[model samples]
Target: MIIQMEGISKSFSGNQVLKEVAFSLEKGEIHALMGENGAGKSTMMKILTGIYARDSGTVEVKGKQVVYKGPKDAERDGIAVIHQELNILPELTVAENLYLGNEQTVGKTAWLKTKEMNRKTEETLRDLGLHVKATERAGNLSVGKQQMIEIAKALMTNADVIIMDEPTAALTDREIQTLFKTIRGLQEKGVSFIYISHRMEEIFSLCDRITVLRDGQYVGVKNIPETSFDEIVSMMVGRQLGGRFPELTNEPGDVKLEVKGLTRMGEFKDISFAVKSGEILGISGLMGAGRSEVVETLFGYRKAESGQILINGKEVQISSPIEAIRNGLGLITEDRKTKGLITDFSIRENISLANLKSISTNGWIAKKKESALFENLIKRLRVVCSSPEQQAKSLSGGNQQKVVIAKWLGTSPSILILDEPTRGVDVGAKKEIYTIMKELAEQGVAIIMVSSELPEVIGMSSRVMVMFEGQMKTILDRNELSEEHIMHYATGGDKHVG
Candidate 1:
């Protein structure tokens, strides 16, 4: 075995997160770690990477028992981790970020060997099939590109065992293919990987063995060839998920929002669509197909060069987020960590931020009313947190998403625009979010959702709109929705359907 952890236990403020969990990885093997958010997957991995010390356990690397004091120590012992959240400094160049702490020095002086570092960074990027320049600013690159840089950083360590947490969450399908190729190449070179991802397809395709964790306890491990996807999901969720999406009973009502000839030059042009009250209009397309751009225009985040927006059959001008909110429109942005929530603030503060006017009287805040509002939202959304005062960043990815939903729900908008609502959440959380959308639709709120996952779009949408190369290819009804059909239009294979 390349790595083995047994009888691991950990807790935070008397709340047990992991309870005697056991895991093992073999040399040159791609092992999958499956779990829902807050299921102790991150905690277990953190312990392995020396970010957290286990309360009780034994960790052995290559048959040698060792305890690392920090991440550097773990890296020295041939273990490296690519965290879910991007960890590169925005101010630094790609090469600088890659060799951050382990910089090359010239002749024992404090001066750095800039040329050597850039050359090594270029070599690593080329090896990984990433087309980013070593001297380019990290912040200027797209999320997908930044993700590649993170992988390159991990590979630079030359570790025998690597832990990847949601490594492809921000990547496009093409980038994902490149990553898979890289993983296979590394495996051929005798490097092992502990892959953590919620996407079942990725696990089934890349992993040799799968280990399940639930509520901070080890469930079981199975060989990829012997176990089925349904069985794995049942183990992680502790119950059968009856369906991928809930059945919609509520019918769409009269038009609540309509966009006509919305144009943004190169981003998107002549975009037109209408969403009725109690309807979910799904926007589906490939990455950079201008889905986000169109939605941002509707939400007042981007200026529309020429367009007409009508709410309740009356034209309204929405030039900013504040204006959109005041006009009864709410947007749940795609990138939740950076664009949606204030990570440093408490849950109560975030939930109350959107609708401050409703919770305030005479320009003075109403403390009791605010507390009551937050309490109700917390219980309604099933957000798992110790208290309302807990920082938003402290919650798991699933819980943070719920908080984002709650923040918008607080505004009591008639139209809600959700962009990749369940992007990084778990299946259980996805189900809960779908349920919430259904409930909200039943309450007469129109929903316009933008998603990259075709299953999600087809399953939840009343109608799916396909976009290709910044133009509307087709709008598919429920009866016409299928992965092949959607992809055909999204990839510009067909443009005549409506």
Candidate 2:
């Protein structure tokens, strides 16, 4: 075995998050660690990487017991962790970011060997099938490229056992394939990996063995070939989940929102689409194909150089978010940590932020009104938390996303735009989100979902709009929706296939 942990237990502030969990990874194996939000998957890995000291446990590396004081100690022992949120300085060049703190120097002096480092960076990236200039700024690259950079860092450290958390959450399809290829190549070289992701399809296809965790306790471990998706999901949630996606029963009504000639120069151009009162319009494309940009323009976050936005058959000039809200538009932004919530605030505070005017009495806020709103939303959304007073940042990613949705639901929008609604969420949470969207749609709310996941777009959308190079290529009916068809339009392929 490459590593093993038994009887692991941990807690924070008397709240037990992990209890007697056990895991094992063999050399050159891709092991998947899976659970719902707050299920102790991350905690177990943290303890393994020395980010958190376990209260009680035994961890063995290559048959020797070891307790690492910190991540550096673990790294020195050939264990590296690449977190979900990448650690890359945007302003720094790729070479600089790659060689950070371990830069090559000239003959024991402070002068750097920039040329040599850049050459090495290019070579390393090329090995991983990533083609980019080493001198270019790291931030300019797509999320996928930045992720590859993190893996490159791990390889440079000669890490034998690497742990990746939600690695493909923001990657395009091509990028995911590239990442999978790189991982398989590394595995062939005897580099074992612990892959953490909520994507079941990915785990089933790429991983060799799977270990399931539920509510901080060890569930069971099974070989990928021996286990089924239904069994793994049942193991994770402790019950059978009826369907992968809930039934969409919302019937289409009149067009509630329309955009004609929506132009944003370099971002998107001449986008035209209409969403009915009770319809779900899905937007699908590659990373920079302007899926989010179109929604952002509609929400008044970006100014449209030329466009006519009609809501309820009346043209409205929405120049700001305040105006968008006034015109009955609610946007759940893509980046929840930065754009959706105040991380430092409590759940009640975050939920009431968008509808402060409604929850407030004159100039002052009404505590009772805010509390009632918080209670109602949490119960309705089934957000798991200690209390409404719990800090937003302390909640799991799935709960944090619920709070963002709750914040917007308070506005009671006639038109709702959700961007990557279940990007980093687990299968259980994803069903809950889909249920909520279905309920909203049934109540006559027009929803525009911008998603990269083709299955989600195909499953939920009443009509799908595919974009390519910032322009609307083709919009397909629900019957015509398929991964191949969407990719054809998304990649600027000819509309009529031969």
Candidate 3:
């Protein structure tokens, strides 16, 4: 085995995050670590990467037991990690960022060998199938491209054990395929990986073994060929999930939101849609099909050159997020880390962020009232945390997303827009979110959901609106929605609606 962790245990402020978790990886193997949010998968990886010291147990790398004082120590011992959050310095050029701590120096002068670094970075980028130039500023690249740079940085270490956390979250299909190919190539050279992701298909297709963790305890491990999808899910969630989506029980009512000729120049053009109270209107399309742009415009993040927005049969101008909120509209943005929650703030602060006015009096916050409100929201949303005072960044990705939802829910908006609501969430958490949406819809909240996952859109939406190149291609009823039809319209093919 290249790496083996036995009886690994850890805790934080009386909250046990891991309990006797055992994991192993063979040389050249891609091992999957599966768990719901706060399930200790990330915690275990942090321990192995030397970000946190394990409270108990043993970690052996390459048949030798050694204790790493920090990430530098781990790296020195042939280990590297690509965190879920990008850690590159955006201000630096790609080549400079890649060689950050280990710059090549010229002949005892301590001068940087800039040309040599750039040459090597260019070679690494090309080998990783990235088109980005080594001299390009890291901040200017797209999130997907930046992710590739992170991979390249890890590979530059020549580490035998690489830990990846949700590495494909921001990648397109082509980029994902390229990444898998790269992994396969590296595996042939005896480089092993400990992979973590919420996407089950990726786990099955790319991993050799699966390890399940639940509520900070080790569940079990199975070889990919010997285990079924259902079995792995049951292990992670601690129960059997009956279906992919919750049953929709709400029926459509009067139109709660209406848009006409919404245009934003090159972004989207002449788009129009109506979402009725108690109905889920799903917007589906390719990644760059302007779905997020349209929703952002509606939420007042972008200005629409010419358009009409009608809420409850009355035309209104929402030129800012405050106006949108005052008009009973809420938006859960696509990038949760950047747009949704304030990572450094407490959960209580984030929940009240959207509706501070309601919980305040005469420009002063009502402390008791605020605490009560946040406590209620935290319980209702099932945001698992040590306390409401816990920093938002300390929670798992799923819990962080729930806090975003709770923040918007606190506003009590009549129309709620969720863009890529379950992008990086686990399957169990996805179901919980679906249930929350259903309950909200049942209470007469009009929902407009934008999702790239076809199955989610088909299962939860009352009607699916397909967009292509900033144009509204067609709208399909539930019966007419299919992966093939959605892709056809998304790719500028003929619109077919039943």
Candidate 4:
């Protein structure tokens, strides 16, 4: 065994994240940590890396008890973590980044050996089978390539135990395959890994053993080949998944929105799509492929230089989100923490934000009416909170998303746009969100959803539209859309798509 964690428990403020979570890693093995969002996987890893101090636990790394005060302590102990968010200075070159803090200085800082450092950087990237130029700026690379650089940096530091959190979340099929090959080679060289991710196929295909967590508790540990996905999901969920995506199709009525030649200088160009009442249209693409930009433009957050927006078949000029809202459009932005909710406000306050005018009576605010409305919505949405008075930030990520959705529900817009609605939500909350979307559709609400999860787009969407590098690619009927096909089109590989 390479690492053994016993009775590990961590708490944030008063909230318990990991409760007696126990797991182990073996030498040269890829152990997968499976759980939904906010399930304490990251917290446990942070404890190991000393980013967090565990409330109570005993951790043995390499058969020796370890106490780490910070990431540097963990680094010296041969443990490294590559978070989902890559930490890199954009303006710096690859060589400069590789030797960022520990730079070689001649004569105690008279000058540094740029040529020598660049040569070493070239060797490091080449060792990973990548041709990334040493002098190239870090921000110039794709997300996939940037992830590879992060991995290379970890290796350059001579880490024995590597914990990769969602390393392939944004990578393409080919890039993922390349990553798998690299992982296998590293494994052969005696480096162990703990991979945390949500993709079922990748977990089974890449991991040696799968450790499941549910609601901050360890469910079970099973060998990869012996355990089926159905069994693993059952363990993680603690109940059988009875049709994860509920069947609640509503008839798409008259067109609620029509966009013609929607253009925004260099963001997205000549984009055109119409959404009808009760239809859930999914938009998908690589991270920077203009999926969010197009919808943002439609919502009037970004001005479209050349576009004719027809809501309910009437042309409207919307210069801002307020104007768009007045024209019956609602947009749920991608990032909830920074953009979605008012964390300082109570649940009721956040829920009633979008329709303050409607909730208020005449010139004065109607407190009773607002409370009654939010109470009804709270029960309907199943927002897990102590009460309506609870702060929005006190709720979980999934609940926060539900609150945002509830807030928008008050607007009663003819068309709704959801950007990465289920990005950080757990499986159960995700199911609830799907159910709510279906119910809204049944009630004749038009919804446009942007999701990076291919399964979400394919499963929940009545129709799917793909975007590639600043342009609309192809739109497919639900029956015709597959993960592979959507990916092909979204990445500008029409040859593979058709």
Q: Every model's Cα RMSD, please?
A: 2.4, 1.9, 2.8, 4.1
Question: What tens digits encode model 1's per-residue C-alpha lDDT throughout 1-498?
Answer: 989999999999999999999999999999999998889999998898888999999999999998888888888888999988778798899999999988999888999999989988988888766767889999977566788899989987888998999888766555677789989989999999999998888899999999999999999999999999889999999999878799988989999999999999988989899999999999987766788889888889999999899999999999999999988999999877887999999999999899799899998789998998898888887888999899999998778989999999888889999998887788877888899899999999999998877778889999999999799988888899998899889889856654
**Per-residue lDDT tens digits of candidate 3, residues 1-498?**
889899999988877889999999999999999999888988899899788999999999999997888999999988999988778788999999899898899988889999999999999888767767789999877565788889889988989889999888766444677789989989999999999998888899999999999989999999999999899999999899988788887678999999999999988999998999999999987656788889999999899999899999899999989889989999998778778989999988888888788899998999988988888888887888878788998888878889999889888889999987887789888888899899999999999998866778888999999999899999888888888888788878875433
Best by TM-score: 2
lDDT of the candidates, in the order given: 0.89, 0.89, 0.88, 0.82
lDDT of 4: 0.82
**Candidate 1 clash pair list:** none
Task: Give the TM-score (vs. native) of candidate 4.
Answer: 0.83
- TM-scores of all candidate predictions against the true structure: 0.92, 0.95, 0.90, 0.83
Candidate 3 RMSD computed on C-alpha atoms after optimal superposition onto the true structure = 2.8
> Looking at candidate 3, what is the lDDT of residue 58?
99
**Candidates 2 and 4 compared by TM-score, better number:** 2
Name the lDDT of candidate 2: 0.89
Off by over 4 Å in 3: 93-99, 102-137, 140-145, 496-498
Worst 10 residues of 2 by lDDT: 170-179
Better of 2 and 3 by TM-score: 2
Residue 305 C-alpha lDDT in model 2: 99
- How many Å off is the CA of 378 in candidate 1? 1.7
